[model samples]
Target: MTTLEDVLALVAIDSVSTNESALAKYVYEHLIVNSDLEVERIGDNVIARSVGLHSFRVLVAGHLDTVPGDVTASVIEGDVLHGLGACDMKGSLAGMIDLALDKTPRPVEVTWVFYAREEISRSQSGLLEIAELRPDLLVADVAVLAEPTGGRVEAGCQGTLRIKITLGGARAHTARPFTGRNAIHRLGDLLSFVALYQPREVQLEGVTYVEQLQAVSVEGGVAPNVVPDVASCVLNHRVAPDRTLDQAVQWLRDFLGELLDEQDVVEVKDWAPSASPELMNPHLTRLVEISGETPQAKVGWTDVATFREFGIPATNFGAGDPLRAHRSDEYVTTDEVNRFASVLGEWLRSTPNTSGTSI
Candidate 1:
């Protein structure tokens, strides 16, 4: 089947985050039946590798699971396939599957990884599962995370930090609210600060990384007549590669310092580190050359950071628009999928210049 067909088929199967058993099984069986590579399945993650003795090994990885959406609502109009996961990743997955099934000989060895739980928290990442259970399977000179980038090289992903801030207040009678502080009312100042936040832009290796801050969730209520005594809100900060997790957290604290009282509590709920743009790396540089498109910074977080943690220099390159990911109107075109397949196929078949290699 064509890559477009594969994408439609994959989208038809329900593989939402934390529930990717069926899709994982389909990918595993397809690879086993159609490819000559060694395939392995660990829980919902699937890894397929070519055992050819080569000077370099390249890993092409994509998440098998997508965010919660209507799985059975996939539609194909002309060359475009519209549905959940169509843009965020399934389009690229189809290209990866095509490459995996191809019998063409390439100079560099290849490893195809279709992992699970990428849409959720980083702690439950299927890539981490493979790294813990079978590290050998992921060993590669370089990696390409097939995150939706419209077939261009989206170099380096931003770090993500989720912080929860809780404010304390005293309960008071509804009629006599002036007697006590209202924590819910206190949240207004914080939300206003977040709404007026200006994104910071940092440049590295000619790519600009923009940092963003926004309030994602808020909870604070008691009863219709009772005044709440406590309120909390979760803030999601997209940090640049220039700062560490601690530094980013401190920056957030400083940003909200004046608004946060001594009694207020600020806690780091979750965080994932950022990855620097590795355009200097020969393999990635060659990929950019092959695509003939200028590489841009990956504004959102991706598994490239996870691969970076493993000491593998990775970049994002895939089919579909990054902006359309996770939206109900997400889509992928035949041209986008085909172009991704062509560029990646050529990159794998050709040898990159290893003269001035620097990770």
Candidate 2:
């Protein structure tokens, strides 16, 4: 019952953030009625699992929500599907759905997770709910998130830290500025440091991770005529997978050593741990070999970090150019869709859980 059109069909549904109620229903019904998998509805999330006590379990996951955009879509040249969510992830979801609908018996137990609110942050993510409420569902030997990776095997996403630094000074009228200190003036060193800071490139587990630090945003200035009393800047650090969240924080703080003594206030706004590579694992090694993909270090933060929390070896693999995600021209080739489904379907069917490890 699952065909190429399944991708197109999913692209048409508007699963924007927490508003994915409709799409959630469709996915639940699809798995229950069209596939032999045992399905469950946890809040707005849909999870399906295969029967039989297989030696190992594998999880296939994708988010249902997308950034706001035009949802209209269509098939193109019989090889392409275009519209919002086509590339950012709906295309992969369609492939996952097709895999779920397939009734063929497989060698390993499979679990499918269609989560919500991934377009935003992890706090609003449905995956967090599943993690907190149903940790049992996430137990798998190895997991795959069908994210937009252009059909490559991407591993070990970088960790992220967002810190807000504030400069405080005495507020005063511009006419008598000499009587008060200008907080804005103190921001120059920090801004200059960020602008000229050279990011380090570190190699971990044979994967080279190019780190990044940026002054992503600035805030403050009470009025045009008054000496600003408070000026704040937000810094985002993309740390290498080798560093944990606490380590990254200490690194950032050490970098701002004198500034801390200068009375600048620093607050950590967000911190997400990295998903270090598990290429050494037998299952992961076999997957990369079979897929013929050169393992690359994921530059951005991804849900792979979530699975990493539970010691699960997880990686990203799927169709659609990740660069094209969240764009108005987002699209995926039907040819790639078939290849995605086929590649994973075969991988799951043939790769038994013989690694002698369990989560």
Name the top lDDT candidate.
1
Per-model TM-score versus the true fold: 0.95, 0.93
The root-mean-square deviation over C-alpha atoms between each candidate and the true structure, in angstroms, is 1.7, 2.1
Error of 1 at 109 (Å): 0.6
Cα-based lDDT for every prediction: 0.91, 0.83
* Residue 29 shift from truth in candidate 2, angstroms: 1.5
Q: Compared with the true structure, what per-residue lDDT tens digits does model 2 show for residues 1-359?
A: 23457777787788888888889999998899854588888888999988677868999999999899877654555677788888888778888888888778888899999998898878988999988899888778889988988777787798889999999888899999998888888787778877887888988777788899999999889998999989999999998988877888888888876755466788899998888877777776666776777878888889998988877889888878889988888888876776677778878888564745532
Best candidate, TM-score: 1
lDDT string, candidate 1, 1-359, tens digits: 35678889999889999999999999998899754699999999999999888868999999999999888889999999999899989999998998999998898899999999999878898999999999999999999999999889999999999999999888888898988889898998889988999999998998999999999999997877767888999999999999999999889888887889999999999888899999889899899999989999998998899899999999999998899998999999999999999999999999755556374
For candidate 2, report its TM-score: 0.93
Model 2, 269: alpha-carbon shift in Å?
Answer: 0.9
lDDT of 1 at 104: 88
**Global lDDT for candidate 1?**
0.91
Displacement of residue 219 (Cα, Å) in model 1 is 1.6
Off by over 4 Å in 1: 1-3, 223-227, 357-359
